[model samples]
Target: MKKIIFSLLVLAASFSANAQVDRSTMPKAGPAPEINLSKPQSFELKNGLKVIVVENHKLPRVAYTLTLDNPPIQEGDKTGAATLSGALLGKGSTSISKDAYNEEVDFMGARINFGSQYAAASGLTQYSDRILELLADAAINPNFTEEEFNKEKALLIDNLKTNEKSVSAAASTASRALLYGKDHPKGEFETPAGLENVTLADAKAFYNKAFIPNNAYLVVVGDVDFKNIKKIVTSNFKDWKKGSALPAAFTTPKNVVSTEIDFIDMPNAVQSEVIVENLVSLKMSDPDYFPVLMANQILGGGGEGRLFLNLREDKGYTYGAYSSIGNDKYGMTSFSASASVRNMVTDSSVVAFLEEIDRIRETPVSEKDLKNAKAKYVGSFVRSLEQPATVARFALNIETENLPEDFYQNYLSKINAVTIADVQRVAKKYFLSDNSRIVIAGKGSEVLSNLENVSFKGKTIPVKFYDKEGNAVEKPKYEVALPEGVTKQTVLNNYLEAIGGKDKVAALESLLMVGEGSVQGTPLKLTMKKTNKEQFVQMIEVMGNVMSKQVLNGDTAVITAQGQTVTPTPEQLKDLKAESAIVAELNMLDDETIKLEKIEKVDGKNAYVLALNEKKKAFYDTESGLKIKEETTQEMQGQTFVQTVLFGDYKEVKGVQFPTKLSQSMGPQNIEFTFSEVKVNEGVTEADFK
Candidate 1:
């Protein structure tokens, strides 16, 4: 009881002391804290390898890093030379077999990877000496032969094939090409031809010319003695050839004269990839570096960024969106904000994206925003300091970037001193609203019209179209007139003849197709059945779990998905009925609205376009008469999405031709369905339709 009474008395005294102070006045922050950063021990070998060692005994692990400060070079036809050189590295040495080398590394539980301009190894300090020796042996005496080159070349070719259809991949390559001209190193891409042009001799020559130690820096950090590391590094790198790599000269990147929209048409893209970027001359040594970084953090750093809050939280147009500002020493730097959004909102998203940038440039951020950005930087810097590798990296950066030795020492104070005015100043300087390129790769038919009229602050946005190779192309013609001697029946009859004889296609009564494939990386099995009487059923299973089912048994049509059932709209019902027939193209013959629209190029092939209905356009290969593409619009959840269906791999099944491979795109997702089982006439029945 006495202790409780004493506590109450102390609480009353504290309240009295607090009440005596002013409540409205803000409390002043304490003086900046002192920083005691560790400095790395540095030494240079006669071979020109500069080694930096930082010792910390807190952990039993050590990391050794070798950075080649080679300037970015345009590879021309040999774009994969550096990449091949890196792949050839660590394959094996004269004294060590590849198998034995891998086994020994695994035995010691060490991780090492070699890149074009960098290599690193991290493992327990107990094996530090062996790891260093192994790294040195592989770095100097690499074994490159035809066997590994062939294997690596095949893998690279496969990657290029896969990238051909990926929307994000196309956007990345195209963005670089659009921002920096194709002649620049940043714009070069590795193609199959380029990779094939690389020989083993070429790889070796690249390694010899670029891996010289003159501009190389090795950082050693962790539970190792500085003196021992210096000796080990000298012993390992002493025999390395004493040569200097000549720096590469690159064509400087230039910004646009005015803000413009650059578009690349990707037929299979479900979502549009948008990148609003500008070229700048930023470096770590510039006074605007910290402020620009802080301003970018406020604009689109992460989940808490303004881009996310506005584009995702407010409009729900995308999953995530972000922006970044980067700096480089040898070449021009860039600032960009990128996001992939549903096609319907591509224009709106672009507008909102520009609006955020404009807001930052024209409007100064609030006091709270400035404080939060500073806190974020300060926190990230402090957390990074906990890692020994960060210390080694800081040392290397100071040398390579020509920064003051004490730049990192006052990191916190510099961040805290940044006022709201600094953030606005850098934002305006770097985020060039009037001279930026809005580079986008998407379905041109769906988003192009909307972009042509997009305006920001009452100024109409200018649009430019470019091919995947960054070549300027004429605007795609939207409304082409039907040519003479081409009628609706001419295209239809040609398609029938290309697939099968007209008599054979007309003889088809019932069809059943069992296709197995993937949608967005998920396994999907599609079972579709149709009869001559318009009795149709379609079901989809994702990994054997039925995801959706649609049925039309000559009467009511209903669909089930996500544990809910609903009757499709009248338009959907009409579409289903048109497709319910065993041969969907036959319905076009009977419908009065169907007409020959025009002839256009679909995937570089001359295709005759037919308006099947108010919302569907079918493209048929003019030469082969096979249906090549289907363009349709869908209304889902109060939003309209344009979908494109591609057909290929036609095969004969019981005297009828059917597409064995199918792909469909719907708002940023690709769905590929390949038929494993197909039947005609006898396999489908009323029971199957139910």
Candidate 2:
């Protein structure tokens, strides 16, 4: 009772003191906290493999990271050899079956991963010895069987096929190719032909040549004795042979002479991928490193950045905009600002990016931005120090990047010391606005015209066309001359005849489609039902749970997503009513607002383009007379969304042909649905539209 009374008195006194103090001015920030960095113990093996170990007994866990610091090698034709070899590693060693190896790792609750030049393993500290032994065995004696090689190669091919249609992937490839010559190691992307050229022998050769230990560093962190770890590493890796020394000299690629737009055409794209980049020679050891870091942070490092504010929050052109500056010890890296934006605003987005970048380069950042950026960095850096692996990484960077031992120790101080003038100076030097490549991978038909006319500061940014592979090409011809006597009604009639007959389509009273697809690997079931009486229902289910549902019943249209149901706005209701018909093509034939535009390529085949409205377009195969694709743009909650649907693999249902495969894109995610069952005038009932 006495202690409680004393504590209450103390609390009352503290409040009285606080009430007496001034509350008008903001308090000054205190000095940066000191970081307690653990000095890693090190040893070297006979095979020239250096091992560094950091001890932390706070947690009963251990991690080992082995990195081969080899110089970059240009794999001209066999570009995928290294990648395939990396995937083949960590599967099993000579003495262990793949299944047995994986089972043991899983049993121990450990993670083991391998790449072309690196291997990492971690688990409970009690399993440290076995984990290290397994890591060394897998890294040194990988079982590169013919079966595994074939499987990995086929999977790689499938991945490349997916990337071929990805606008962001194309932009990344084009940006690298434009910034660095395609022959350079930094720029060469693996192609399907390259994958075909890579034989099993090439993968083995790359493994033998590149995965050496002479220039390697193994960082062991977590609860472990340095002496025991050194002995274990020596015992396991002693037999591994060192390869020949890598060549130190390599040529760095140069940026373009002047700012120009390098546009790659992706006709199926609903949005544009834009990148503004320039080459820089910044390294961690450079004096401008801290300044450049602060500059990029103020420009576009996170949600509070100028780019994100201007492009996403203010302009609403994209969901997010970001920039990154790379630091390479090899004297070549890029400073890039990038965004995925709406197709129609691609040109405006580019201008916005340039403006923000130029603004940062020309003007000094405010003191508030500098202080906030420093605080962000200090907080993140301090928080990261809680991980034992971060200490190991810092020690490794000091060794690999040739930095002073006290570099990370003085990190916060350096960031704090960076003045606003220093940020502007470094930004001006590294963020080259005058000589940069604006690489845009987008729909040329929608963006090229406005992009050609985009000018900044009295200078036009010339638009140069390129294929997806970054090869220079002639300007794309978006439209072709229509064949003689082709009209909107003629195309509609051809589609109606191609599906079945106009009479059969009109005779169809109701339709139901049940399909399955996956989003981010989660399986989903889609059910769509429609009737000629202007009643429709669409539902998506995951694991027997309804994810979303939409219903159009006579005069009432409503949507329910994740248990929240809302009535559609008048405009949305009009659009839903337009799409509610069972036979949309029959209604479209009579709708005078829909107009036949021109012929363009859809999936490498000619298709007649039709403008259904200002926000919607439809594509029909010119030869097959089938509706192939449809694109719609909508505005919801002050944000614009572009959704695309691709129809294919038509199968007969009763007397009319219906699409069995549907590929739909919701923003950046693509879901391909395969219809397993279709019922015509049999399954759908009036109650389904409730």
Candidate 3:
């Protein structure tokens, strides 16, 4: 009896211990610390090197950041020159080739990066004590080899070319130009010609003028011993002479008094790109910054924010939408939101965005909204401590912005202090729906026609198309012609088999394939995933790296890439539907006579041509026949390339025929293959497309 009683007692104790809740019936955390912050310790070396040290011995590693405040490179002509110069600096240093430098850095587990901004040239490094010397080498001994410079320059040009094709980039680029005059530093655009002029001499000159230790500040944080770090820096950078201090100059233009409707034409865009931007005044240290930040959070910050709740959850007009205030050095802030809506609803969506903006400015936020926003901001701020790098970055921002060291410590209190009156005042003052610069980049013909003939402050504004150089751009010619004799059915079958096998492909409700290849002598990879309703591609090497396209009800098409989500242009959407219908028709083909036409030179290469037609004469219809086109091309990478495939083949799998092979030329040398190991339709779920 005693043994049984003791076992019951032990089990109860175990359950009680396991069921303990950390927060249940516990006292709430007290208000944050309100302690005064100590000023940063600083000293200047004889050669003009400025050192700012913040000692925090909590972690056993150090982070070093060097910044050279330089003037914006020659105003309007070559905006990206400084950026290109910074990139070229780290390609090769005095004692190392580009490849050798990359290998050494990889082996040492060290990282180095340089970039040019409006006011500074910055380089950052973080590593243990053992790799500090290598970091110094990278900073002080940049060789700027001609070979590497040329290679990097070409790559930059290619990147710019790729950006031009992106809708989001085009919208942002156009918006900046409209908000700030094209000549302003904040609004300047980088052109291909500007990149073309960045010679090795130009990079060397920029480096010589800006990379002076006397005109630079070195901030060292973490487990760094000041004495040891100073010694290492002196040894690596002592001989560097001081250069002339560049003048500090920047101008933020007054907001335009009238609404401007700028349009960028993408002929076959599946969705419209929209951005409504207007200048706002909220400096980093201003009393209104805290309140405004909280207000924007409530207005349209994230999934739970106002914009998302209205546009996505309630109306289903878009997948997602949000707004933000980008606080910069010059106190420039703009609230913007984007969404991809059907062509018919394009105008209605714009009306909704504007209506929400106006509503916020006119009415005070509810107590519930204010509380949720504050809680989210405070909670997220506390959670950010889980990442060391993020903590360091926040610390750096605090220092750079000249905010109090304990600024973040009292973050919640400051946000909580903001009242509904404060929210209304900032919104009224900053949110200018009347004069906002509304820019749309998409199939202008279809979208513009549907929009209520909008006038900027009552003046009619005409839509215009401009190239990257801000000059009028012509419409692109899209010519896709299939070789004669190939029937649509045969082409469809070949394409299906090439991907995998029809049975397996059809069974798969969704599929994802990743491929690696070479471009301009560099290895690159891309990942693509597809389902009946949507497709997504991550081209690992590009800006706006996440791109997605989707189909709805087998008729409408939508695409989200870069920062913009758009539905296809009217014509493009029409084409998309036609393509879908063709695919369906191809799926029905059983047996067809396919013939390989004679080899023909295409794009400077001999390509094998194939044709397909219905086998039975009774089923043949010249008007209804669909053509199939296939070509083979050689791909190269570095010193190696393959005279591989760009061919389409059909094979049977699970009693269905499908295309299984897809090959494309990557550059001068490499060919990429996208192979599927298994594709089975076991049962596709609706959530898979989402």
Better of 1 and 2 by lDDT: 2
Which ranges of candidate 2 are over 4 A from the true structure? Answer: 1-30, 553-558, 568-580, 681-690
Minimal lDDT window, size 10, model 2: 27-36
- Cα RMSD of all models vs. native, in order, equals 4.3, 3.2, 13.7
- By descending lDDT, how would the candidates be arranged? 2, 1, 3
Q: Give the Cα-based TM-score of candidate 2 against the true structure.
A: 0.93
1-690 per-residue lDDT for model 3 (tens digits): 999999999999999997885756757647754533323566667788766665566656556667764444344565665666677666656776778877866776656666542111112234444355555565667767777678878888887875664556777787777676676666787777777766777777767766777657766665666787777767766766887877656566677676555666654343566777788766676778898888789878888888889877777666667888866644465667666554445566776777788788888889889989988987887676654444445555675566776776677788878999999998887777777766777645456675536443355544555543444555422233445766645545554554455665555455444455545555545544445443322234333244334443345456565567787788656445433431343334653454543433332233334433321111121221222222222222211111223423444444544335444432113344444432333333444334
Tell me the TM-score of each prediction against the true structure.
Answer: 0.83, 0.93, 0.64
| Candidate number that wins on TM-score, 1 or 3 | 1
Writing each residue's lDDT as its tens digit, candidate 2 over 96-202 gives 99999999999999999999899999999999999999999999899999999999999999989967878889999888887888878888899887799899899
Q: Best by TM-score, which number?
A: 2
List, in order, the clash count of every candidate structure.
3, 0, 33
Whole-model Cα lDDT per candidate? Answer: 0.85, 0.90, 0.59
Give the poorly placed runs of model 3, Cα more than 4 Å off.
Answer: 1-40, 69-75, 117-130, 331-333, 452-690
**Which candidate would rank higher by TM-score, 1 or 2?**
2
lDDT of 2 at 320: 93
lDDT of 1 by residue, 462-522 (tens): 9999877778899876554566788898888788878887788789888889998886577
